[model samples]
Target chain A: MDFDIKRLGFTLLGLLIVLNWGLLMSSIMRKLGARVAKRYGIRWFQPWLDLVKNYALRSQISHGIMFYLGPVFRIGGGVGLFLFMPMIIGSELWLNYSFHGDLVLLMYFQFFGMLGMALGSGEGGHPYSAIGISRGLSQFTTIEVPMTLAIISLAIQYDTLSLIDIVKAQQGGFQNWTMWTNPVATIAGMFSLLGALSHSPFNLVKAPNEIPIGPPTEYHSTFLGVLQTNAAILHVVEAALFMNLFFGGATNWFEFILKTFFIYFWSVFVGVVFPRFRIEQSVAWFLKIPLVFGVLAIILYM
Target chain B: MSETKNNNKFENPHYAKREVTGPDGKQFIVDPIKDYFSDERPKVYEPNSIPVVEKFLNWARAESLWVLGFGTGCGSIEIPPLMTPRFDAFRFGIQSRPTPRQSNVFIISGYLAVKTLKRVIRSYEQMPSPKYVLALGSCTINGGMYFDSYNTINRLDHYIPVDVYVAGCMPRPEALLAAFNRLKELIKEGKGEKANEYAANFDWYKENQKKIIKDWNMPDYNW
Candidate 1:
């Protein structure tokens, strides 16, 4: 709806920044993850190279139309999320298409990709893919509990359903940021963020060697390339959403990079320290721990 | 139950199929086999990999090899140490992947038993195109210590198109790394592409594989 002809150029520019920054952040995070294990890690551009290799692959098969469209939906969901949010404050270029949508839209839109991936993986006909989808959805429903509560708390506190307003309300000083004022909500959201990113502890869905990458076990070549490209953008956009809602939002590109990187690193840090959780273990933990914090944060807001 | 049946036949009658009686008192032939590990020309993806673009693609493929951590034999022992801090395979962007769909490289780690060889072929074929096979250990070359054994296959390359061979009973992590570096060079130089070669010679490889692996339960093409 914010697709003004004059502002289309700015929208494209914003998408490029998100895309580039997304991959850059992941590579950096991967290299950092390598350092914890005392390894040199991959080159800074490994993610890009991986994407290139997938795209360059010659042969691929299709299970059906949904199998073909799974990656498409995955990318679309990520792109839509990034486009709907304002990445930087006080700039026309960074505003993106945030004007026409509210925070509720952003929250609901996140599921489009997940649902698409589930259908796509279902169409893939790999039993492993189905297992992955079940693990993912089950874990996701619990993950949503904390994240939703945090959002509701913030909405009630700010009296607005728009992320722009929430960020604007937290402006003027670091102390006014939601992270400081609503520690309970911030903590709850941060825990859910780790699960959302599928780090080590909550990475049960992918289940590395057991299920073999879960949802996209059948995807090869360009299909994998599309899913990976979407991942690059999705990772950073998800972090930026946290930054906007919790870390007071970024005032400039430099701050955007710095704040979002550290925000993302928080989960990676936890991933390195902890081994994977069983699907049930994570589901139980989210409900037991973060769920308490989330409810407490909401009650505190009231 | 089906596996026990095959092993029983392989041990006793020593033939793939046998004549059995039907419940209605009629004799019938049961050929438990269908698809031949044949020399038929299998379809290729036909990369149309342009010269300039091929170079770039090759470089990318070499740099980001997701090795299928399949240990069909004893050589898998050497692979773990490669991932350890001392060798650090991750530094080269080389990590053992869990699935064939996401992986580009298959490391046949040691002497291949006929049973494991069956699975190895299945997994190798499952991988996407532009893939590489790195045969580790003398066993993969000439069956190593298991050369005299009846269950184990003698040569690895006979069953699959091998791009690189790391020689030794169990090549150390350093040699594994060196072999990987060589494989990377081959990949970048466009020599690491053995997937197409395997496709072109699918029948020959299958013929060799079937010679030792008697129970042909799988389809012609794994994917």
Candidate 2:
């Protein structure tokens, strides 16, 4: 009902923890992947990661600066998203707020963090970094429409632009969660998340086998450490946000974390198993599915 | 943390020793560990009464020029096998990096066409100090093929001073090795500064690089 600065600060701190958690998870995932590669004698994977790390993080000062800046901008965008969208912290009386400005705001705001990273990488003056940024921006064009459709679906379901109101309306748990109620929309969201995370099958941005970890290739030192940390943290944030939107928040903190982790694990598992999609295929795939879902969500809501 | 952990677990198997057919074609055990431990840890060069052999070794180590993967010409293709197991340039402490930031050597492999020449200059400028350049072929030394094309610069050394010029349309890999040895010799004789002085004409190099890119209306790789 009321915005408290202290409460908001606490929430921001929790957000920081979530970001750090994402950074750690990404590192763990890479390490785990490398270890598996080593066991299988797939020698290239570990060395590949090491080379990228050295090129991007261990090389010099300029790269170091860009690497650290990546996460800060990412967190900034996350903060902005959390501020605008619906979030329900189930502490009985802790807080609940939702406001919808416009679909444009939510959609374009996502680009800020990504764009900042691209710019930072470009300034490092590495060809690979430039190549990566170009690929990343191009991928955006493909996923944006489908994701927008999903957003529109939610917008229609509540007949209001505010995300908080949507969550409040969908409070009846599993049956009320958008995915269960509207499977098409839920599936569309999953596909979009796949694109957003740059996960396997859609992982064009950091495709090691191709672009040599792209923009981060020139980053080094404390800067790269920060970027890597932020990457994992952003993953956690994205996963949590997805869970909050589509799956009911747990009645307790334990349940909440467990449910979120459950989703996170599934996402990671699916992500690791799938091979990366070519840029064109990813674009075409997202364009069709989410657009259809968007039309369906609109019709169903109407 | 993960890098260190993995680095510790993995012993750079690429650098490990195994049985290899010697020049006599007889199988001989080559133990890198034995070779590593057999010698006293090689120290950095000190301008003192170090033994001649030790001095030579240090000079070799210092000029063990690791190249960056900023390929600018047809000559760039030669780099792959040079670093592969057969050639194993790493024996000289020279490794190929994918980024220019970390490399101490810019092997301007061959002719710098107006198109790729801009990138070559940018890469050259990005490399840290105490760097050396090896003009790999006649094209890199004096634009052998495209000498009158106006698209290729006739003398790269006029732009970025070369320490050793390996002559050939495309110099054989052996020539590259020879050029490297020559660079080591020059370094031993305190001629490393000569390369740096030539490279230090930042203004002239920038102008020449700009003319190459602009006169030919060449597009950057991504652009």
Candidate 3:
């Protein structure tokens, strides 16, 4: 396997852009929530300040090797997932490393960071960390059912696992997008996306008193800063993944930003008005209507 | 032992001293005094090499002071109003964070009993670097009415470095906000970098801490 230095450089550039803009996106979402409560929220650069302070901390503690590597795994997963996909089409430079694999590989890499985090947090020796991961992974499996079914439906309908080909198929018109043609799959995918994003009603991983900020409880200083950056990028990348798969892939940066924000807000809107549910409730809720929608989506594709 | 007996340095015979086997197989007793007083010390603080970057960091750190949300004492009651529309603490980038790992400020809201002090020390130590401790009531400064009480510690600084002390039985929300303003000033000037001071004076602080905390079942450091 030959390596292209230019492609690698562009990949890094793309990751940096995503991570930087990702913080701004999150702060905007936070401001939106604060406005709903009639309060002036933090400035857009506030998250950046927090990140700097965390990194500039005078001291830090480590539980062990695995505990140290948890955030490393998390950031790795975020960057890896983005690099595997085609960011822009119709040009070789924009293809990323898509020639190396297909959506099947991208699908598998989705679990890479999460599984690493689970293993790393388990090593941190905090009961809350363990409990959080246990709840998170359990809730994680239920949501995967609908999302997986939706993806399978898309791949089957398009007759390809290559994301470039999939994106190309939807070009030339708005109505050709999977979101319009396969509304059932889009609903199922977005509903499952809510759980994937860990918004309210499915945020049992961050239960009020049960877990002290969940899996990241033991992480501090630069370790946490790394995780925060990764989280920001990962959220945007996850939203972008849906945009490409459902809405038509962006022809330019403006379209990319608009679609990703719209997809992200769909989950945020659901989170705002709903009260939280128990882990069991979230799992059962997914298994019911969302899972039915998933099966229906597959049947519709057939 | 005789010379320091009046200074209250008598070792309690009831508690067995902990012994550890070093990595090279040398067995040694764990003595806080001996470990603390030894001439040599382990280096911990990184050199503040870049003045421009350091200045910027201090300002940023000052700006985003995420107070640990848990109230350690009665002063905790004043915290809610600070968040309400009337006070709005978030406007200054000062908000309550749920976890100790993420928080930069720990507001010891009121008096600290011997029992609670142990937990406070543990929580305070668990907080990441550049952490600030603000004692909210007179009780934390000198135990106030609990000054003569057997269960409370009079001077909070004896156990950990305190950055600010807001005087009141239970200060009002406005007082708390004023204290935050003072804290922000200290942080802005880069004068309140006491986390490293606490680490540098670890033995002295632990000696003072163990003086009152009789049942010290926890490890040497909370981490």
Point out the higher-scoring one by DockQ: 1 or 2: 1
Residues B161-198 of candidate 3 have per-residue lDDT tens digits of: 99999998878988988888899999888787788888
User: Residue pairs in steric clash, candidate 1?
Assistant: B38-B203, B39-B203, B139-B144
Residue A208 displacement (Å), model 1: 1.4
Per-candidate DockQ values are 0.62, 0.05, 0.52
What is model 1's DockQ versus the real complex? Answer: 0.62
Give per-residue CA lDDT, model 2, range B94-131, as digits (tens).
55656565566788877787667666755665554446
TM-score order of candidates, top first: 1, 3, 2
Please, what are the lDDT tens digits per residue for candidate 2 over residues A8-49?
775666666565455445545544453444422222222223
Best by DockQ: 1
Q: Model 3 residue B177 lDDT?
A: 88
Question: Model 3, A115: alpha-carbon shift in Å?
Answer: 0.7
Q: Candidate 1 regions off by >4 Å?
A: A1-3, B1-41, B45-49
Interface RMSD of 3: 1.8
- The TM-scores of chain A alone, one per candidate, are 0.97, 0.79, 0.96
